[model samples]
Target: MKQYDKKMIVKKSNELIDAGFELSLNESRLILYCVAQILPKQPIKPDEMYFVDAKNFSELFHLDIAGVYKTLKNAMHKLGDRWATVIDKNGDPKEIRWIISRQYFENQGVLGIQFHPEMLPYVSALKKHFTQYDIKFISRMKSSYGIPIYELLTKRRDLKEQTFTIDVLKRKLKLEGRYSAWRDFKRYVIEPAMNDLNNEFGEFDATYKTVKEGRAIVAVTFHYKPRNKSIPLFDKQGNPSSEAPQKRWEEYGYRSAFEFREALELSETHEFDLTDAKEFLKARGKPANK
Candidate 1:
């Protein structure tokens, strides 16, 4: 019943973006609307919500399963260390549930009903982009029945934040090359290509940093920011920009050598048997016969 504030929604949306969750303009707007209505004192039961169903939520915006999944995933990742609930088919707690944080709830209030804080941003964005008729229908649902359809969803526990060590050269090429291969690869191949692409599409400044664990390269850091808003070079439309491959490659280049070594070690631990010899033989080709 309460009116939502635009500034509050924008503020929360920006916060989520800075935290590595990229949301669309429309999504940012809608999430703010929902967060504005959530009661701070009461934790809404996940099962008692209606808009949790991917199908139902998708209908609100005429989106497909993949779209719904992606939106929810991005939102969940943004909530980071938030609290939420998981329910089973019978609308009962599944023992495992999402536990959202008070800060997240306080920042992004709930809209139509109690929802996982992660869900709020996507749903809000959907509302923002849909047709007036669709918005009205959703708004009516919020005002009347509310979204009490959370049973079909499973809320997973937030894993403890573990620092991921990236091993770029070893992971990709499997070469026992020097750590400099990564830097050289990025400098010659990745950075140049990225710069060219950005120039063609629009320029985004690329920066890299290194992380080391003792003597090894642990991970490399690649940070990118658009040189300006006028150059819109995001390859994927609607999806979050952070998940793009170019961005990932750029980031991999910045990781430390120790990360690459750790990745190699991990790969060795999970070594799998290769039963298909045909492909292997084909790879060796005529040289093996000679």
Candidate 2:
């Protein structure tokens, strides 16, 4: 678990990013921490246990040790109860748990998670068309909506634009009823989240403009532009997110970048990003190309 930067990376397919799920800041922190722990290029499995150690959570997120035990103990149950609604390959809306099981040892402050088999394609072995960001960027962000908004825009960085219908955005953020007024949504949700993204990100500027109809705000478009700073191919955590890899392959061994199909369960064809081959090569104990 001890890697560079002491940072946690949350990499997920764009589908999961746009899926309808609402998690509080604590819940987001707990799940994201576990997702980042997935060893690089090692595909996730439904039965594989992913754990969130309260001590690890405390150190990474700058939370008090005592408080993390209590906070995460509570968030553990709530997160287990959460399920995401996503559109399936047949264009059907399906409700699926990103996590299929949650277990915690009494008084240990360690919570274990099992990724729903349905989510392996989205959260693991990502090489392309996925959103990769260090959770530390929003670790301390107080806005409940900031993390989701950050992801919605982060995934579209290649296109530099993401537009969402007002209704659709709300459902994705799980903000349908709250922030009932345009100003409230803008001031509380949009603006604050934009600030969080801008502050944590480097070599990028985040901006937004509202689309209105006869004084009614109907949609919102987020824009990203590169800044002058030069970034590296990988982060302090050794996460190679700066480089644009090819689109992800739908099935393992169904494509060339990954040869260990037997290592993962076969998934549906409607998938996409295969991250760099270095980690996969490294896992096989082969000398990766420079």
Which one is best on TM-score? 2
Query: Any residue pairs clashing in model 2, and if so which?
Result: 126-275, 127-274, 127-275, 128-273, 128-274, 248-272, 248-273, 248-274
lDDT by candidate, in order shown: 0.31, 0.67
Report the Cα lDDT for candidate 1.
Answer: 0.31
The positional error of residue 149 in candidate 2, measured at the CA in angstroms, is 1.0
**Candidate 2 least-lDDT 10 residues:** 262-271
**Where is model 1 more than 4 Å wrong at Cα?**
1-209, 227-290
- Local error of candidate 2 at 94, Å? 1.0
Model 2, 1-290: lDDT tens digits are: 33225645677787889899989888888778877877445655569988887887777766767677778878877877788888888988888876778787757768787888887887886655566665666675666787888777666544568788889988898777888799998898888777766774433578899999998899998887644312122332345444432233333223441232211111111112224233343444433322
Superposition-based RMSD of candidate 2 using all C-alpha atoms, in angstroms: 8.6
C-alpha TM-score for every candidate:
0.22, 0.73
